[model samples]
Target: MPPDLAIAHDFPLASCNTFGIDARARCYVRIASVAELAAALADPRLAGMPRLLLGGGSNIVLTGDFDGVVLHMAIMGREVLGEEGPDGKFTLVRAAAGENWHALVQWTLAQGLGGLENMSLIPGTVGAAPIQNIGAYGVELKDVLHSVTVYELATGRLRSMAASACRFGYRDSVFKHQDGKGLVIVDVTFALPTAWRANLGYAELAQAVAGAGLGAPGPADISEIVVAIRRRKLPDPALIGNAGSFFKNPVVSKTRCAELLAAFPALVHHAQRDGSEKLAAGWLIDQCGWKGRKLGAAGVYPKQALVLVNNGGATGAEVLALARAITDDVRQRYGVTLEPEPVFV
Candidate 1:
């Protein structure tokens, strides 16, 4: 190891993950810069060890003690990089990997940017945003992402990948795949529109805007409304340990959705551009009677059926057990297999 590099052994990770599972990492290091990350990865002592690149830890579930190194990304910075495009119709902004995702949204709004408003209050760091292609209300990270700068672990080379290269999907990106294993995100750049318009596409958000009586709402207004809605629907990780929405809204073909809808009239679903229907995972779990229910120390959040919470001193095993029960019930009742949103380590 380099003389300047600091590494801790047997580090407790309960506080690092939102699920609050009392797991420990065999080795841990806080990486603050690209150079530091390179050095740490190149260190012979750390060679051949399994690596976990952790960001805000909001989108993960630690199943047990990690047997390898945990590289906690702490790189931080954010700034407006000025306007771009031939017509200068877009304003570009950049934030380092470890910058709090919600803080970045607010910062952009403060600078009069509007594209990120609908995703307000989404937890996790900027780097994790791309990995999950985090979305909320009516907006997704892919909509505003311009490019991402990453350090390739295998080659020890830095490269800038455009949005097209990220291969974003619903609640997914390239970073979640095998090809993305050693590519550590350093920073992300977004291209916000100069001619901005409020995206009130989501029915609930649109209704909220109407209820708020805003005839002409700006980015901040939409953001405030989104934050309010999330506060009411989701539990705060600080107050109640949770990894936000626990399941991805299952997508079904239009025919399948119609069949299910006919069988169950009260089904909550949204139509996708590709003609599929996105069924609400929360509603499915609620229908399965898991809401506010507990198994051991893990429970489904009372306010949001989609959220699985650590009631108190919950083990990762307990959380997984509760999640499995809920998944099984939903699958049995609805004939749809619900997939967990958080990465399990």
Candidate 2:
């Protein structure tokens, strides 16, 4: 037999991420399929080690060597599941947990599917997308997610949950907290449309596309514009070691927003549906002069201060220290606590 299971013996995790930070998992397994995942989880060899589920490694800040088994989901598959709501021709596609999220977004747009064009260049995995309900350019994963199938770690049973059942909110979802605490996402289904109008209300996006000589654009056009804007602004994680965004935008009550706005007339905030307002964490960090500031390998990105970079070789602790300092500084200045977007394990 395969000695119960076959896995890489103590693999280095630094190269598996865009962050390029060095760390190691006591044990590591590359799950090529969900069947493989089941086998790995049941392997008696890894009984007591903590389990970690990782995808594209685009949004996490691995702060230390994991004293556990790490399962790298690489299962691959994609299919048009079906059509949906009022538009019989609109489609839904199922994506494997390992599928690159941004590539899938590009695929959908190329197929003339319109729901996810705004989220063009975001990096991560399809499975992880639903966890955070990934959003950009005014569109979020929850907006198009039809359902997600997960493998419960406790019982090894496959359970599928719908969007409403997923409890999706602004960058928050049930998969991220409850119901999915120990359940590992295996695949996700997205509801898409054959044709749709794009939301260009975001000033930067509007400016980018308008400047690109297209007032009203097609699905691909919008994707191109979004990518272009992102390219010009956000530093590529491949070149610079950093998770896409390091902090969650803080949502403050309208009264609090008013208070801050009065103090800083140019305060940037987006009004939420719940009467709260979401403040840009990047803007806040930039205002604090944290942008492009590094201390012994860890630093804030120059253009996108909300993103922290691992410049060459940052120990997990150093990056964490930088992040904690920024959070404290921002809190002391604005009286609003900032939360890190990455899950620290």
Candidate 3:
């Protein structure tokens, strides 16, 4: 072990993860710097042990105790790297992986940066954002991402990767794949537009802004509205044990979408730029009568059918069972397989 590295044994992880599953890590370490991370990884005592790189724990479901090492990223910092792009049209800002994601959004807004306003109040750390390509309202991380600094575990060296190299997609990135298994994000950089425009691409957001009587809404206005909307729709992980939305909105071919529309006239869907259609997973779960329904201690959130909650003392197995049941029901009824958003551990 490195001189500065402190490893704890049998660490309780109920509070680490948003789902609050009572799982334990055989060994755990809080990594506050890249040097410390590299040193710990190089230590021979921990060699060949499976590792879990944990961030805000907002996007994972622990099924049982992990019999390996848990690297809890705690690196922190944020700064303005000044302007970039053609004729200096964008402001480049960077943040460490351990920083709270929502806090970073607020900080950027405080600095008069506007591009991140549409994604306000998302949970998780900055490092986890790129891995999941976190998005909300009408904005995604990829839209403003400049690049990411990562510590390659295999070589014990640092590398800066461009957004394109990350291969971002709807709720996905390279970090989720086998090729990215050895990479650990240390920080992220974003290019915020100098001339900002409010993104009201989502109807609910546009209606809320209009209803608020803001004839000309600013970035702050959009951010406040998005925060309010999320507060009203999503359950706070502190009060309720949940990992936000449980499933991704299934995308289907235009022909398939048309067929489903003909069979179910009231089906909720949004057209994708790729000529496919994205169906609302929440609406599907609700239509299947899973909202507010429970199996053991696991249940669907009453306000949002997309969220699955641990009502009280719910085991991870119970949550998995509930998810499977919901998926099976939705598939049986609509012929669409619902893919879960959270990583199952």
On lDDT, the candidate that comes out on top is: 3
| Predicted candidate 2 versus true structure: per-residue lDDT over 189-267, tens digit per residue | 8878656777887888888888889866888889888898788878788888887888889999999999999998889
Ranked candidates, highest lDDT first: 3, 1, 2
Model 2 C-alpha lDDT versus the unseen true structure = 0.84
Worst 10 residues of 1 by lDDT: 1-10
Better of 1 and 2 by lDDT: 1
| Predicted candidate 1 versus true structure: per-residue lDDT over 269-304, tens digit per residue | 999999999999999999989899999989999888
Q: Candidates' lDDT values, in order? A: 0.92, 0.84, 0.94
RMSD of each: 1.2, 1.7, 1.0
Candidate 3, residues 90-175, lDDT tens digits: the string is: 99999999999999999999998899999898889999999999999888999999999999887988999999999999999999
What total of clashing residue pairs does each candidate reach?
A: 0, 0, 0
Candidate 3 overall lDDT versus native: 0.94
What TM-score goes with each of the models? 0.98, 0.95, 0.98
> How far off is residue 241 in model 3, in Å?
0.9
Top-TM-score candidate index = 3
